[model samples]
Target: MNLLYKSSDESATSYICDETGYYLIRLQSKVSEQNYKAAYSAVLESAKTKPYQKIILSVIDDDENPLSVPFSARSWFASYFSPQFYKLAQNQVDVGIVKPKTKLQTNMMHVILGVVEKTNIKINAAYFDKEEEAKEWMKCPT
Candidate 1:
């Protein structure tokens, strides 16, 4: 597995990519609407070349804040790709792994997962736990 790291002003600390069709995104701060959009854009742009089979987003929320309106609404209207880049990827990508740090927040997780499910995205799996688990999941075959 070949992993590369990139930095963004958003919550994410690094973006890891492997030639085997998987991406692991590690978040370092609380996720905000603006940050989410930026991260999504970065990931989407990267995906154009890598064409990952799965994307594991490791969200670490030390504050456990409620989902922002834009993010929630984007999840709600996820069917249309015009709003969120993540949703756009969901339409074509093979899998989406959303991992929340510590004990997962059910509502936020559900919202994202529901959007993925509703969109009929081929999610190999989803998880919420330590960063290691997320990384391992991203490496594993679907």
Candidate 2:
């Protein structure tokens, strides 16, 4: 896979293997609400340029993600993730979230997923505790 973009703060990075349709996103130790948008946007931007837009997002977050999401940020987050997920979910894409351990982010992620499910959102996504398991689900390259 070739690196497509790296954030200036080193909080997020993206890579794509054009030949295989595998897109990898690596989130560093600390991730803010904006970082999530940045990472997802990076994937979407890369997808726009690809010939076929069937992307497999292999999101690796070691489960120890020190997510800095203050309560005041919740409203903005709801607005952000919903539309973002809607656009991606409408496409032929797969999302794999890899969390190696349980952390504050895990519960938050579950809350997000729960809302998506309860609202009957159509997103092909799942959370895995291992990178290999997540990769297997997304058909990510080894």
Candidate 3:
């Protein structure tokens, strides 16, 4: 994995995995809503450099605490950012998400995934307990 971008506060980081050919976004426990947005934006910007077909989002933290965004914010992002992402990838993108540890965080992810799934733009997404699983899934032919 090659580091593509990292937030100023070190709350988030983006990488391009050579093995899976997927853009990976990792969020730390300290990540905020603003930093989360910036992280995705950074990924989209990096996508311009080299088009990618898949993305893996790792909100899982090594410790107990994990990244969690409010339902409203997640909905807003799905409505606002998904379109830009779809366009940036030329109308297609698959996403593999490593689920958070806590129930609350996991529920929030389901909501965001629901919002994204409801959108007109087709953004294929799946959830996994581990980043390795997501990577394996992402590498398969779509």
Candidate 4:
């Protein structure tokens, strides 16, 4: 995995593209609007050459393992409404693993997962705990 890009702002974020063309996005803190734009920009730039429409998103809280943290409602809505997100989510599959340590976190993840699934756009997406399993789910069979 090579460091494709890093957007260190309120949160230290790093995006890595693995050998199988799967993106692994790691975040250390809460996400900001700027962070979302930068992230999407990075992926869009990469997508120009290699269609890495698959992503493994891992967000960590405190000393815990990598997990998914809820973006603000603004970001959530943006994901569904933005043209950039449309480009990313359309015909794309992203694997999300949010190591939820709290009930609220788990609920939030489920809610976001549901929201993503219920979107009008067609995208193959799901949440998982194991990175390997997520990668396996994202790949097309040879």
TM per candidate? 0.64, 0.64, 0.83, 0.64
Each candidate: what lDDT?
0.52, 0.57, 0.77, 0.57
TM-score for candidate 4 = 0.64
lDDT of 3 by residue, 109-129 (tens): 777777777777777788888
- Give the top-scoring candidate (TM-score): 3
Q: After superposition, how far is residue 142 of candidate 3 from its true place, in Å?
A: 4.2
Q: In candidate 4, how many clashes are counted?
A: 3
State the lDDT of candidate 4 residue by residue for 31-82, as single tens digits.
Answer: 6666655664666666656666566665555435333334663354446433
Q: Tell me each candidate's RMSD, in Å, in order.
A: 4.6, 4.2, 2.4, 4.1
Worst 10 residues of 2 by lDDT: 51-60
Pairs that clash in candidate 4? 67-98, 67-99, 68-98
Residue-wise C-alpha lDDT for candidate 2, range 40-67, written one tens digit per residue: 5666666545633333433344434554
Q: Best candidate per lDDT, number? A: 3
Clashes of 1: 0
Candidate 3 deviant stretches above 4 angstroms: 70-76
